[model samples]
Target: MCHTGGCCILRRNRAGRRMTLSTQTTAPYPSLARACTVVLILFATAVLAYTDRQVLSLLVDPIRHDLHISDTQMSLLLGTAFAAIYGVAGVPLGFLADRTSRRNLIVAGVLIWSVGTLMCAVAPSFAMLFVGRVVVGLGEAVLSPAAISLISDTFEPKRRGLAVGTFFTGIAVGIGGSILIGGGVLDLVRDGLFAATPVAHWAQWRLVLLAVGLPSMLWALLLLVIKEPVRRHDQVFEENLPPAAGQNSLFPILRRMAPVFLVVAVASMVDNAVGAWAPSLLIRQFGMDPAKVGVELGLLLMLGYGGGMLAGGALADRFAIWRGRNGKIELCCLAVVATLPAAVMINSHSASGVMFAVPIYFALSAVVTASGLSAILDATPNRMRGRAMAISFFLNVAIGAGFGPTAVALAGDHVFGPGAGLGPAISFTVVVSYLLAALVLAAAIRTRRS
Candidate 1:
């Protein structure tokens, strides 16, 4: 319900002699053209952040084989190493976003993660690689929370789903781009496209890491032009330009928003597990090459994830308008339920079956992400948006990224004994986690209406 707003913020001139009052008007609330530009930039940022994160997905086999590690160890590389810090660091960073310059934080984050990614490409040992992953996690921890907070302020509540969804298309793009771009590069190098050259010194995986990670360093610069948005909640800003509240002050607020936040967490947990294990599924059961699979599925993933997110956001907004405030939550609930069939499709043994089903899963999953973020923004106040989103991201990464990938790996390695265990593990996690998410989302709607 954050509205377009006006406020009087006091500033001290360089002379430091007098307090100056600056009028904040609602007149320039990111017009459609400007909003499109903002969303495009955010979408691009999402792509970069995720591309760096998922590059490791393609490198899992090499990293594990080179390090002489177990699947569990590989899972840690994918999950715990990154998620552990992202979850905890998000709160403080989110606090910073609310209180300081989100644009600067994003700039710092892009630089940090990009450097961590480069460090990952050069790590001489597994320990060094783990440290790099931790650094990447810390840097990435600031993005979506702050981005979501900023987006919440840019668009009115009713239009929020669309704006947020547009920004998130980056997630889908980054996910697909990582595989397409990374996998394509790896395939070319392995196929000896660079055979007689000095570039032959580095391994394909290292090249893949460097290729995706390095571009983000340049992308960070684009953030400098972005203006921090005027803060609002529904139709009003708190009378005085008060100091931004701390995370501890947000606990009571967070407690009230728990049902929806928890829903987001569980939903993320399920989706992340599916995305992490998908490449392996294609490679293992269907005898597909990692390089080949990446090219083939990359387009599908973009369509599924990006297209789905756009549809979900726009639809959820309409639903909210037609049915009232809680309508958007209902759409999210349906999205969770919709994933059940997608889960079954993705876990299928046939390559064609899984391929056909995976995109559907991506599209359906978009609803949860798009609607969930919009819902959180609607429920919380403006000053608390960043921290609230940080908490949501903490839950999101802690459960989704932290546990999902690892759980799938463990299920395959320990529970199902590594042969055909992965498919089942992914399917099981999807059904259980997504079902729980659906129920929680529904309950949250009821809680709101209550």
Candidate 2:
């Protein structure tokens, strides 16, 4: 007999006796208040992860002076070193999430990355620092696949866009918070607040890394309190079935979702490229103080990118109801196209002009990013969500994080002539990446329709 929360089925056992099969073995759906709390914790954890990850951007000049590294080498520290491990580890971790306690996985990941961050603070050489970053990447690789899978099971399918969107805002805040906090810490160090402390002899950049890394350890303990929701079953039979070949593997799903994956990869490439270089661009081209740029850029990102995540989430939910599968991809395409113009504006000669353009660029990028993720969740079933997210993470870090910063640096050092062409190089990278993203998203739309 059917019931409110679940159903019971009558079955014949091997002995030919009647049996009742109940689908209520797992916990019931969480209360609204409980769900909100889960999302809040996830959001905060994401903020911490990204803050630790992106803080290096503001520390670029300081690190270079001490270690004598080139832009390309720094970019490797920024992108490839971290991404190589992050991308590779994500797949196995993702599958583990599918079979294990996601909460525990997240807690362990948080502790790991936090330790890695501390390692970066003490590293005396470039190679050691790169190793530290790789460790950080390994820890962070556990978050998205597990977190997204958790959220998907926590909320109903229809509301998932908003939930996922809210979680991603942590990225906006984390990115912004890193700069804001980094800059504030730098100011304090310069003002002699730590002059009397034991860390007085430490470099200003190392202190910043130490400060950000410490909080995450405490946060990891807090994550221990969150309960893991039961995994949801697919409502449609077809969704639960294997491919036409009857093989239980991820290959068919991956092939089917290639265009969607490419869209995410391309979007991440531009987003990371812009983020990694914007601080440097301002310092190099406009000669603004790093502290001041941090405060300003941090505010812009928190407001612009954060707002974009919320709006994109709301819009994606609405679009899903209004237009079905095609809606989210359409939104992505529009956002990608809009991003091109704002990207070109990064080359603006005046500081004010660039400032005006940056928030708009970030907001649009957030729209694409947030909506694109929602689309992926919409397309995949619950059983495969973790691995699906892992594939996306692998591609995102491998292609986007792996190459984004290096591409900009290479263009600056080689094509634009060492120190002077950062502004133009940023613009060039953004335009090319977005153009490719738009094409892939268009193809994704067509594939969905057919």
All candidates' TM-scores?
Answer: 0.86, 0.90
Q: How close is candidate 1 to the true structure, as a TM-score?
A: 0.86
lDDT, candidate 1, equals 0.76
**Top candidate (TM-score):** 2
Question: Residue 348 deviation, candidate 2, in Å?
Answer: 1.1
lDDT tens string, model 1, 11-51?
A: 44233323322233455577767766777898889887987
- Give the runs in model 2 whose Cα sits over 4 Å from its true position: 1-26, 235-249
lDDT of 2 by residue, 1-450 (tens): 433156655655333444443343355678778888898999999888988898899999999999999889999999999999998899999999999999999999999999999999999999999999999999999998999888877876556657777788887677777777777777876787668889989998998888888888999889987899988753211223344211235676677667778887888888788888899888888899998988898888888888988888788767765675577778889899999999999999988888888888989888888788877765565667798899898998999889999999888878788756688899999998889888888877887778
Task: Give Cα distance to truth, residue 335, candidate 1, Å.
Answer: 1.6
Q: Cα lDDT of model 2 overall?
A: 0.82
Q: Which ten residues in a row have the lowest lDDT in candidate 2?
A: 237-246
